[model samples]
Target: MPTLTALSPEILAKYQPVIGLEVHVQLLTESKAFCGCVNKYGGEPNTHTCPTCLGLPGALPVLNRKAVEFAVLAAKAIHCEIRETSIFARKNYFYPDNPKGYQISQFDKPIAEGGWLEVPTAEGGTKRIGVTRLHMEEDAGKSVHDGFMDSVNRTYIDLNRCGTPLVEIVSEPDLRTADEVFEYLTKLKEILLYTGVSDCNMEEGSLRCDANVSVMLKGAKEYGTKAEVKNVNSFRYIRSAVEYEIERQIGVIEDGGRVVQESRLWNQGEGRTYSMRSKEQAHDYRYFPEPDLPPLVVGAEWQAEILKDLPELPEARRARMEAEYGITPQDAMTFTATRAFADQFEAAAKKAKSPRRVAALLTSEITMRVRAAGIEMEASPVSMDGLVLAADLAESGELSSKMLKQLLDTAFANGEDFLAVYEREKPQQISDTGAIEAMIDEVIAANPKQVEQYKGGKKTVAAFFVGQVMKASKGQANPAVLNQLVAAKLDQA
Candidate 1:
C-alpha cells in the first residue's frame, strides 16, 4: 500500500466504514463438547484430552447436553429464534493445535438466528445491530512456542483446551464507526454476562472477537474490500484496531492503491495491524456434515423448558429497576451493571426508609468505594443493611455530611462493617433546636462584623454566621437546620 496523509474531518466524512464482529464464547460446561474430558483451564498439557477429542481411530463423538442448554440460554438472552434442527459440519484447517484435522462446527444450519441487540449511539439514542447467527463449535488446543531453553525453534502443543465447547455469535455488517462497534460489543457482553452463559473473561481466552472491516465512498452502493481482524481479546483493543484498519483502508484507496482482502493480526505493542494471510472463503474450507454426529433436534418441550426459567435480560431488567426503585434511568443503569449487584441493591432499598436516598448513596458513595478498593459490589466490606442504616442516618439528618465521609473512610480502612461501626460509636449530631439556637446566639455575639455585613444587605454573609456556628458547635450541629436558622436570624438583624 502507498503512504497517505491524514485527511481532515470534512474529507474523512466523505467515506464510510462498515464493521462487523464475530464473538466466540466458551461455554461453562463441566466437560468437553464430545467427550468426558475436563473442560477447565490451566491443567498439565495434554492431560485433558481423550480419544474423541484427539481424533483417534475407532472413536465416536457425542454431543454435550449441557453445552446445548448453555447455547439455548445465550440465544434466548439475545432474543434469537431457535431453530428446530441443526447439523454440525467439519471446518478443515491445518494447525499444530488442531489434532482432529478439522473443527466440528455449524454450517448451513445453526442453533439459532435472527436476533438483534440495541446499542447506544453517540446521539444519546440507540441503534439496532442485527445478530446473524449463534452456533456451537469445538475449540482447538493451544500451541506454546515460548519458554524454550535451547533456541532451536520448538513449539509445544497443549491439548488441554481441545473439544471445549464454544458458541460463536456473528453480527451483520451494520456498524459504521468504531464507537458504535464498541457500544455493540459492550451491550452484547453485558447480555452474555447477565445470562451467565459464559464467563466472558478475555484474559483467559474464554471470550474473543474477530472484526470484519471495510471502507467505501460515502455514496457508494457497494462496500470496499474487507479484511478480517483476528484474535483481539480486549474491547479497547478491538475499538483501536477497527479504527486503525478503517483509516488505513481509506488511506490506501485515496493514494491510488488497492485494498486487499486478507486476515490481519492486531499488534497491541505496536498499535497496528499486519497481514497474516489471505482471507479464506467458505468453499476454501470444503465443509461437510460430520459423519459421527446426527442432526440435533430442539423441540417445543425443550424450548419451553429453557424459556420457563429464563432471566430477564439487561434492558428489561434495567427498566424494571427504574420503575420499582423510583430511580433515574442513569441510576438504574449503574445499579444494573450486574444482576447480582442490582438484586442486592433492590433488596437493601426495600428495607430502607428513604429508598431514593439509599439509591443515591449506593450509586455515588458505595459504588465508588467498592471500585476504589479493587473489589466488586458483592465483595464490599459494608453489608447492605449497614449501608441502608448509614443512608437512613444521613436522610433523617442524624448523620452530617462530614460524619458520613468519616464513617465510610473508617469503615473502609478498618475493614469493619458500616453498621457495626455505626451502632458501636456513631456521630452525635446536635439536632436539638434549643441547643443549636444557643450555639447560633453565641456565634452572632462573637462575629459582630459578619452580623453587620448581613444587616447591610450583603445577605450572602449568612454563610459566615453558619460557619461560625458550626465551628462553635464543634461540627456537631445539623448543617441544614443551622443554615436555615442563620438565614432567619440574619433577616431579623
Candidate 2:
C-alpha cells in the first residue's frame, strides 16, 4: 500500500462525499429508561444498576414517562413528525458492559420521523438537511480500559451509564462536504441545547456523534461504500476525521482500489482514522420486538402538553431578539447562545434606558471581564440589575465612556457589582458646559502651536485640545460636551 498524501483540488472535486450523522443524546432524566436506577453520570462501577437494567430473571421492564416527554420535545425541536405509537425492540448484541445481552431500542416504528435542519452553507446560503428519524433508546454501560490492576491487559466494566435514557437522531445523507457536516451538527446541537432536552456535553458523553462517510464520482447515481467513523469526541475532530476519510477513500479509488465498509475510530492524537471493525448491518443486530415491554404511545394530547414546555428555538429567538432590542445579528447570537442568557438580557434591557447600551456592555465589557477571569457569565461580579443601572447611567449621560470603563474595571477588580463600585467611586462626569468651556479655554492657551495648526486648516488637530481638557478634568470630562466645547473654542482661537 502506498502512503496517502494530500489530494489536489481537481482530484478532490471529481468526487462527492456523502455524509450521514447519528447522534445519541442522553436525556436529563432522573432515572434509567426502563428501571428506577439513578441516571446520573460518574459513580462507582455497577452502583446504579437495578434488576431490570441488570437483566435479572423475572424482572419486568417499565417505560419512563418523563423520558418519553423529553424525547418528544427534542424530536419536535428538529421538526420531526411525532408518531402516535412506537415499538421497542430487543437489539441482540453481546458485550462485556451490556449485561442484558440484548439492548432494548426502537425499531420499525420510531417516536418521530422526517425532520430537517437548515444549516448555513460555506457559500453564504442555507441548505436543509433531512433527519431520517429520532428514536427513543437506552445507553449501554461503559468499559473502562485502563487505570486498574493489570490495566493494559484487563478491561473494567462500569454499568453506571447502563439503561440511561437516550434519543438517537439520525440524519439523511445530504452532507456533501466536511464543512457542511460541521455546520449541520453545530445547528443540531444548538437546537437540542435550547430545548433543554440534554446538556450536549460531548466530554461527559451526554452527546455523541457517529458519521458515515463515502465518496463517489460527482455524477454517479450510486454512493460508494461508507466507513462509519466513531469515537470522535468533538465537532472539530469530527470534521477532520471526515476530511481524512474522504481523501483516503478518494486516494484508494485513484489507485485502483475499493473502499470497504467498516467501523473506524478517530485517533485525534494522530489526526487520522484507523479501522475498528467490520460495520454491522441492520440484520446483524437481529432486532425483534421486546416481549417484556409493549409499544410506546405518545398521543396528540400528550404531545400538545409536551409542546407547551418547548421554549422558543435558537433561530426564531435570535431573529426576534434582534428586532425587539434593535441589536445586531451578532449581538443577538451572543445574547441568545443559551435560553437563560437571552432571558437575562431581555429582562435587563426592558428595565434599562437603552437596550443597545445593554447590548454593548454585555458583548464588550462584561464578556471580556468574565473571560479574563476565567469564570462563567452567571458568576460575573456584575449582575443583570447592575447592568441595568450601568446602561441607564450611560444612556442618560450620567456616566461617560471613560467613566464607565473605569467603573467596570474597578468592579471587576474589587469583585463587586457595578452598582457598588459606581456608588463608592462617585465619579461624576463634567457635563456643565460652562465648566467645560473654561477648561477648553485653558487647553487652547497652553497648546498655542497646536491651536494655530487647528486654525490653519488642520481641523483634525482639535483632538489634541480635547485630550488636554479631559486630562485637566482628571478624566472626568463629559466626552460629548467636551467635544463641542473644544471644537468651538479651537475655531474661535
Candidate 3:
C-alpha cells in the first residue's frame, strides 16, 4: 500500500499533473435509448430487459427521439456546438453484462463538440475547462458476483440497465490538479441538472466519471502516459484518486521507471489507484457503424425546437440572480446551485418586496432548514408563496426579525407552510406605542442598576434594556419599536 503523503510545495512546483474527466450522465427519459423498456433504476434482475436490448436474433434497434433531444440539450448546456450529422457506431467489447456484444455509441462524428465549462477557482475567478465532445450511448447492464472472495461461484447478470440512454462528456486535458477536476465536475453536474437532463446520482450509477491523470515535468511539452481511474462514485473520491495517481506516477519516474498507459480502479478503501488492465486504444475496440440505426441528422428546425426549451444555464443565471436580486456572489451561487433551488428562490424573491432580504433568508435560514430535514429545496414544506408571505410580514412591521425567525422555526418543525403555522399561531408584533412604552417602563423599573449605568454615560447598556423588554414581550416585541422605547426610557432614567 502506498502511504498518502502531503506533497511539499517545492515538490509540487517541480511537476504538473494533467487531468481530464470523462463523465457519463444517464439521461432521465421515459424509455430506453433504443427500446420502449422503462428507463429506470432498481428493479428485479433482468426485469426491464427486452428483445432489442438483449440483442435477439432479428430484433432491430430504433432510436429514441427524446434521448436525442436530451443529448442535444445537455450538449448545448455545456456550450457545445451541435453537429448537424452524427453517426452511431458499435463499440465492440466482451463483457457478461453486454448482451449485444457491442455498445451503440458515437465515434468520429459525435452529437456535439467544442464546448467549455467554467469552474470557479479559489482565487475568486473562473477557469474554463474545454469539453472535447459530448456523445450519446447505451449503458450496459451490471454483473452481480454472488460468490465469496477466492471461491468459484456463479455470477448473475442484471440487464435492467441495458439500453439506458447516456451522454458521455469528454473534456480536454485542461485540468491541472485534482481540485480543478473536482470543480469542473461540480459545475458540470450543476449545468446538467439545470437542463433537466440527468439526475447525476452516483450511487444509482446514473452518473459516473473516469479520470485520465498523468504527471509531467514542469514546462515539458511532451505528456506523460496517463492512467484511467474508474469506480469513483463521488467527486471527492475521484479527487483523492487523482491526487494519489499523480503522486504514484511521480514516484515511479523518480525511481527511473517509465509510466505505463493503463486502466485502473480507484480503491476507495485503500485510497489508491490499482491497475485493472492496459488501456486500449481506439483501434482495439474495432469500431464500426451501427448498421441497424440510420445516421442521426439534427436539422436547423430541430435545433431551433430543442434550443427554445433549453433552460437558462448556470453561468447566465448566476449573473442574472446577482443583478436582479442584489445578492452577493456567494449568495447567488448558493441560491442557484441547482435549478430547483434557483426557481424556488426566484419565485419567492420576485414576490417579496424586499428581494435582498428574501435572498438572505433563503440562503441562510431556509436552506439550513431544508438541508436538516433532508428534503430538496423544491420539496420544502414552506412553499414559495408561504415564504413570500413571511417576508412580507417581516418587512412591513407585522413581525419582528426574531418573530419571523420563530415563525419559520415553527413552520419547519411542524412540516407545515408559513401560512398554515402563522394562521394557527397568529403571532403578533407589539408595535403599539403605548403597549411598548408600558413594557419598557416595567423593564426599567426591574433593572435599575443597568438603568443607572446607562444614565452614567453607558449608552451601550440600551441594548440590555431592549433585551429585557423583548423577553417580557416573549420576543414578539417589534425590534425597531422596542429599541426606540428602550433608548427613550433609559434616557429619561
Candidate 4:
C-alpha cells in the first residue's frame, strides 16, 4: 500500500464502515458446563480441572442444567428465538489453552437466534441492531505470559477457566459508527445485567468482545474485506480498534490495493491494529456433532417456564421510568444503569413529592459525591430514604440549593446519612418576605452606586443585590422568594 495520508472530507464521506461485535459472556453457574469442577475465575492453576474437562480418555461429559437455564434466560431477555432442540458439536482445535482437543459448542443449531437490541443513536433516536445468534459453548483456559522471573521466555497455562460455560452473542453487520458500536454493546450489557445471568465484568474476563470491521463505497452492495480485531480489553478500546481498522481498510483500497481478510490484535499502547494471521491460515475447526451427548431439548413448556418470570428489560424500564417520573431521557438512562439502582430510584421517586427532583438530586448531587468518594452508590451515606427526604425538602422549598450542598458535604465528610446531618444542622430556608426585604434594604443602602445603576436601566445590577442579600442571610433565603423580592425592590427604588 502507498503511504497513508488523511483522507479528504469528500473521500471520507464516500465510504461507510460496517462493524459487527462478537461478545462472549461467561455464565455465573456453580459448576463447569460439562464437568463437576467448580466454575470460577481465579484458583490455583490446574486445580479446577477434572477428567471430563481435561478430555481424559473415556471421561464422559455431562451437561450442567443451570448453565442451560442461564443461557436460555439471557437469550430470551434479548428477544432471541429459542430452538426446541440444539445439538452440541465438537469444534476441533489444538492450542495450549484447549485442554480438550476440541471444544463442545453449538454449531448448526444454537440455543437461540434472530434477536435485536434498540441502540440509542447520537441523534437522540434509537435504531434496532440485529443479533445474528446467541450460542452456548465452553471457555478455554488462560495463557499467562508474565508475572514470573523467566516469563520473558516462558508461557503458563491455567485450566481453571476451561469448560466454563459461555454464550457468544454475535451481532449483524449493522453498526455504522464507533458510537453506535458502543451504544449497542452498552445496551446488550445492560440487558444481560438486568436478566441476572452474568455480571458482565470486562475486567475479570467474564465479558469479552471482538469486532469485525469493513468498509464499502457509499452505494456499494458488497462489503469490503473484513478484519477481526481481538484482545481489546474494554469497550473504549474496542471502539478505538474498530475506528482504526476501518480507516486502515479504507486506506488500503484508496491506495489501489485490496484489503486482506485477517485476524488482528489491538495494540492499545500504539492505538492501532496489527495483523496476527491471514484468514486463509485460520483453523477450519472441523465441526461435528458430539457423540457422547444427546440432542438437548428445550421444549416450549420449559422455555415458558424459564421466561415466565423474566424481569423487565433495560429499555422497557427506561421508557416506563421516563413516563412515570416525568424525568428527562438522560436521567432515565442514568437511573437504569443497573437494575438494583433503578429499583431504588423508583422506590424513592414514588414516595417523594416530585420524582423529577429525586432524579435531579441523584444524577447531579449524589452521583458526583459517590464517585468522588470512590464508593459504590449503594455504599453512599445518602440512602434512598435520605434521598427522598432531600428531594422533598428541596421541592417544598425547605432547603435552599446552597444549604443542601452544605448538608450533603457534611454528611459525606462525617460518614453519616443525609437525614442525620440535616437534623443536626437544622438549616431552615428564610421565605419570609419582610425579612428578605429588610436584608435587601440594607444591601441597597450600603451600595448607592449599584442602586443608581439599577435604577438607570442597568437592570442586570439587580443580580448583585440578590447575591449580597443571599450572602447576608447565609443562603437561608428561599431562592424563588428572594428573586421575586429583589426584582420588586429594584423596581420600587
Note the Cα lDDT for every prediction shown.
Answer: 0.88, 0.91, 0.89, 0.90
lDDT per residue for candidate 2 within 395-454, as digits (tens), equals: 988888888988999899989999899888888888999999988887788778997788
> Alpha carbon lDDT of residue 197, candidate 2?
85
TM-score of each: 0.92, 0.95, 0.91, 0.87
Better of 2 and 4 by TM-score: 2
Range of the 10 consecutive residues with the lowest summed lDDT in candidate 4: 1-10
TM for candidate 1 is 0.92
Q: Please give, for residues 35-122, the per-residue lDDT of candidate 4 as tens digits.
A: 9999887878999999999888999999999899999999988889999999999999999999788999999999999999988788
- Predicted structure with the largest TM-score when compared to the true one: 2
Q: RMSD of each candidate?
A: 2.5, 2.0, 2.7, 3.4
Error of 4 at 19 (Å): 3.0
Distance from true location, Cα of 250 in model 3, Å: 0.5
> Of the candidates numbered 2 and 3, which has the greater lDDT value?
2
| lDDT by residue for model 1 (348-447), tens | 8899987798988888888889889999777888888888999889988999888888889889888999988887877799988889888888888888
Return the lDDT, model 1, position 84. Answer: 88
lDDT by residue (tens digit), candidate 3, 14-98: 8989998899999999999999999989988899988999998899999999999999999888889999999999999999999
For model 1, the run of ten residues with the poorest summed lDDT: 1-10
Cα RMSD for predicted model 4: 3.4
Q: Which 10 successive residues of model 3 have the least lDDT summed?
A: 1-10
